[model samples]
Target: MKLESYVKLTFLSLSLFLLIACTSEEASKNKTEEPTKQSQTEKKKENQTSLKENIPNAPTNTDELIQYPGGKNAGKSIGILPEDEKKQVHKDLDEFPKITEDASETEKELYWNNLLYLFQEDYIDPQTVLEKWKMESFGSPDIEDPRFQFKENLNVEILLDASGSMNGKIGGKTKMELAKDSITEFSSSLPEGANVALRVYGHKGSGSDQDKQLSCESSEVVYAMENYEENNFEEALNKFNPSGWTPITLALNEAKEDMAEYNGDQNTNIIFLVSDGINTCGGDPVAVAKSLADSNIKPIVTVIGFDVDAKGQEQLRNVADASAGIYANVNDQKGLSEQFKSAQDIAEKWDRWKRDSLSDLDAIKVDRNFMILAFSNDWGRKRDKQNSNLISASDYLYYEKKMITKEMYNYLSDKRDEQKYLTDRSQEEVVSYLESINDKTYGEMKKSIEEKYKQK
Candidate 1:
């Protein structure tokens, strides 16, 4: 019985030892397999991250990939593909022939054309390539003394359209409201001695066939020709609301009469006609504008078509052309305000000119420097945008869509870098040219800069 018990104990110990050895072997196998699996996963993630690192702020989706941050398409998408078309595009890209250095010119052209076709939405127009380098004309620089001076008193008359369409909304505010605010700001900021007048048209009757005659004849000077008075000007603006048919002809005719006393010889007359539509009343505005231009008033009529339709713009442009003036079409409140700001700048320059009869050489130099800085900044922004867009597009094509081979993507990237280098050199050259002419006389500087950049 002792021998049998010892034998049973030995058998039990051997069985336990075998069980422990099997468990240890299983744990070791799991540990070895687990590291191999984890390594594969980490390697895959590292490869993806490295690919994405090619583009700064790399887009994860096609929508973000095609959106442009600047250029003429600002605030808008560069390209948007429908689902079916996108699938077809992916297939085409997958089968696209690779570009090679030893390829014939025609083959190379075809390959590049196909690639560029995919990104045609981001194509920059050659005509507008150097548009930011274009200089703005401040005043007549050819004169012996380039000063914004007027020998006579200045008269600024505003013919504001109170037609029903002025009630239209832009950016949550009525066109009339925006015009009133801008006009108020403009008049208040004018030179102290300048005479200002406010006239309202189509403010008397409702915009109905029954009241068309009254509306057509409704043109009156709400504020007489005098220096700006805040309370009086605000009261005059409050007296009118958007109403009645547009009687542009009658308004222009009445404006001639209003400024009949302020002839061009004694007063530098400037008439700003703000309208949203063409003349609804049957009258000849172009003829009237010509008459006003020919009269002793000799007013420079600047017709501002505030959100005017194409047809209305044409007629308004004709009126301005007849008067030997300018036409400005404003789409929003901001654009309208910018137009007014231009006039305000003129007023300020006029005041300065009156105070100082001679040219402000220091002011001219500062203005030139500011223009140069603006040009440089604009060029840099465009360059960076172009480079970022190209890199993002390449990454999207190569990794996300698997459309292009690695070699092709690398070639494209190298070409993009080269183009960026060229543009950088061009920007530096242009900025250097502008700096070189910083101290030149106004006429000489204007001529040199315009001649150089206009051709570009």
Candidate 2:
């Protein structure tokens, strides 16, 4: 009986040992597989974090907005892309990201910046902005006379008012002193072969009413109409002083007689009247000025009011208007000098007109070429800037932010290329039009270009 009991106990112990071994092996297998699963989960989270860190957040402040380098908006912040371009982009792209209410600020800004890749400004026509070429001429160059071809005799008459008011000071110099200096400088600078005359009015008597008749009849040609000679012209300017009443009417009448030989049909006459006041003596200067302008000597009367009163300026302006001329007011020496400089420019142009017509034509060609080059370069720079901005946005959206799929990014690139192609075609058309008329006569070119491009 004892032997049978021992056998039963040993069998039970073996069965229990087998059950404990199976449980321990199963637990160890599960522990080993769990670490592998945990490692995969950790790696996925790390990859996602790295992607978010790769791109910086979009700007929130206006100062951080991207700038444009060229175009009408140069030196300004980039604005929202136009609705037309946005619509076109939307048409080509599928599954475009939406800015939901819950979207982060960075995400919203990123979407807006990406659309700037398609931003384009309206094309500006060069003809609407560029100035037409103006050719300076003396009388008409097409005249048959040889004298008119190279030089149309130019007569410049300087009518000086030596009224008592001319003694007033401006910029530490008397009005008469400033006038003499500016007149001397202007006369010295005149083109050779041009005639100049200096006529002084109201220099013979005092401003007193008792001497009004003598002052009114005092207009005299100090320097007869003749080619400018430095020593002789200086003597002429020194012959007068500020001492009398104004006789503007008498001066205009005498100027007509002084330039009677030089008719408008053969010469260009210009009169520069320097005055400190209106005609104090009883006479209608505006009527006389009109008569002088209508005479054989068609003079272009330019009046300079030197510190004149409002009433005096109005009277002088009326005289100039009646004579189909201009009136300028000057209160200082510098202002006076600038007025004379304008006349000097006209004289220089006359000097240039005396040169060979071929040289003048060459100058016109050079000016036109410069204009064309400037326009072409401007167009090219705007195109390059536009393309550069588009590509830069595309790179940021696709490579850095991963905001756009590769296919969508490529489609944007194609749109940029298409835009560039269209601009290039337009630029080519403008250049061709300009070059087509390059060889045309100055008159023809001026007329055609002005007719085409004048402000609407």
Candidate 3:
């Protein structure tokens, strides 16, 4: 089978399995009716909060349980084209004059409207213009294709600054504490298959000159790169305290070796180097960054200046530029959280776009099938009415001892044939237009993803 067919078949099977499971669960619950009814009665009473009638209810943790006001009315009220508008469209199509080469703008518009009316009859709306606008408004999220060689597991190494400055307060908490909170949330949100590691610098000694030597050499892989778990990560965060001088260069160099085993074009390696000050270890960080950038691991190093001074930011930016990475500056706890959130948001957005696009494609096909079914029903009704009229006329003629003329019978038969021909031709046109739009839609989606994320 073709790849597309295989994918669709797999989805259909999964959907069927879910449906059966739900049906079985419903049946099992129906067998225990008394307890279920009693629990539901009590639950409904407990849910009464006396909120304003006009206010929309808040969505629950599981969105499926939230009841929107108006129920079925909510769905019935919304449409791309209203029922009255659809009737007007049909009326206009029937009355509009045929087009000419020298037709006025109004006539030309009517001609186009008639075509649109026919297409809409099949529930197909050509939305290339709207799609283009959407592409312009939101651009596209970076999405890496799974078919590419870059299919190996993701590896992220966070080089956190544990220098003395991190002990400083931010929004009633130490900077270290804020970083921990943001990182925890970030880690929790990452997709399950990712491998994560934590490296901390300057957590061994005081910032005083006496402890400078120890601090400079304090960069360590406190947690090696491995599948992340909440408890282990929390424990790792608790083990470190901010006390020593900053040793950013050492951190960068260590990160290279930490990810050396996973080096390849197939795997993605990323580094988040967070610091609040310039390197004080008297080593060349820019040169170290350059080396890491040129390593086999090919890490994308993002240097984050966490509430740094102007000079510190400039130095950090230089290191980022040297490594061909991006530099971001965050000043407070909120900024820190947002920066971390953005990292996860990028991945989430790509997944969302793909899923939504697939749903839209399926909806288009479903609408097409529904349109065909409706058209067939309409044709069946006309056929049955024509046959009934013919039989009644023949019976009346027989009762009067007279026969219907052959010419009249042939004319009626021809009308039925013409109706069938018109229906089939219009159906063909609708299907052809839909196929073209579907092709364009898929192309646009592919371009959106490839243009943003496909690696050079």
Candidate 4:
């Protein structure tokens, strides 16, 4: 649950895209035969086109059938992790920041690997340093049981902004419509036994009577954390008839209380917060975020901004970062659907870290000896929240532990996505970004972590 280094590698993905798009070399090559897919630009353009069309492919329309009965049914996982993966494995948390004087050479490697791995840079080649670390590495969640791989279960909580603003179009479709479709896809991807929940705000129908009006502050518990029907998530989306302003802070607190009903650790809970405006029911979101952090619930709260102003996006950003989660600006259904795609590697690693940290026999004891790993999106604090739904979830998993199914394989990603926007390293941007940090010996960054993470 501690904050480590920022994984501040200068990602040149955008520059890389530009470089490929406007490659000086292209002019000399061919004014010729429709460039083949071999050309990166041609390929990327095609992919982007496909991505745009598929964005609305999820359950955006009310008439579309939700393929999965409930959120827990199986489907082909959408995102696939890259084959290369790098991890910092450690014996335990106590080994962080190795105090050299207190440890010998052999122990330092394990602790260093674990500390750095806690916040490993996605761009680094995990396979490159095998010899340096002299340890075997596991890239991602191995598909052991296709039907029931040993991934840590995530109790998903979806917080939808059913405000009028959401009714607006982003990427050519209503944001609310997009969210519901994406949720349907997201839920279908989960392993059958995974727990889930849904909380929709501003869903009360509007009417002249004050009591009848569904305000932005209105939050409905459409589902608790458990296996659900496909219609369950869609029904909530259908209610997003646009009647109010956003109440993000109130929504989170409501979710926190609802999640408290579960008996499991907060680590199992995941919150997807979708919004489109500044708090109409204004309250201090920062304070609420700090509360979640303090509770050790380590919930991964991903905030999606839809067709909103810069200020609205910033507010959501702060809440997400403070809560140990991710902030994504998704204007259309496609962007929203891909939120999981962007964080796929982290999700897989999270499951693996949990599996590796504790043997199946140990789920009962809540072993203090094992420390948890976290990603920028997978903040460590949200994992501490107590949940009531996980009791049956754990039992269901224990009893139905089947081999991973095709459905499960699609879910596990071993590493970061290959095309995820890392600027293709324009030397200028990389150098400039590196220099601004006072390029003061990175050795300091290295030294601080070693000393702090070292074990007794």
Q: Kindly list the per-residue Cα lDDT of model 3 for residues 197-256, writing each as its tens digit.
A: 999999998999999999999988767787779888889998989999999999998888
Worst 10 residues of 3 by lDDT: 68-77
Report the lDDT tens digits of candidate 2 across residue range 1-456.
899999999999999999999988999998999998986666444323312233323222211111111121221112243545333333432233422233444444444433532333323343321322322222234323222233377788999999998986654568899999988888898989888899999998898989989989999888888888989989888888999999998998888888888877777777889898889887799998899877877776778877665467678878977886667655556557766765665567677666633345565567667667766775676667566656755665577556565656666676567667767876787677777877776456546655754511
Q: Candidates' lDDT values, in order? A: 0.66, 0.65, 0.58, 0.45
Which order, best to worst by lDDT? 1, 2, 3, 4
lDDT by residue (189-232, candidate 1, tens digit) is 98799889999999978899999999999999999999999999
Model 1 lDDT, full chain set: 0.66
Whole-model lDDT for model 2 versus the true structure? 0.65
Residue ranges of candidate 3 with Cα displaced over 4 Å: 1-150, 346-456
Q: Write the per-residue lDDT of candidate 4 for residues 1-456, one digit (tens) a residue.
A: 123222222246666777887775686465543454345454333322211121112121112211101111011011221222101111122222212223333333332222222222112111111111110111212212121222245567888788766665543456677777777887767655566677877666452346333464488777767776776756745554766656677888888887665423423556788887767666787678767755645555677766555467568768876775666654446556767543342344445566565233233112111111111122111111101112212222223443222322222111111111121222223223323322222334234323432311
In model 4, where is the ten-residue run with the lowest total lDDT?
Answer: 67-76
Point out the higher-scoring one by TM-score: 2 or 4. Answer: 2
Give the total clashing residue pairs for model 3.
Answer: 0
Model 3: lDDT equals 0.58
TM values, all candidates: 0.54, 0.49, 0.46, 0.45
TM-score, structure 1 vs. true: 0.54
* Per-residue lDDT of 332 in model 2: 53
The TM-score between candidate 4 and the true structure equals 0.45
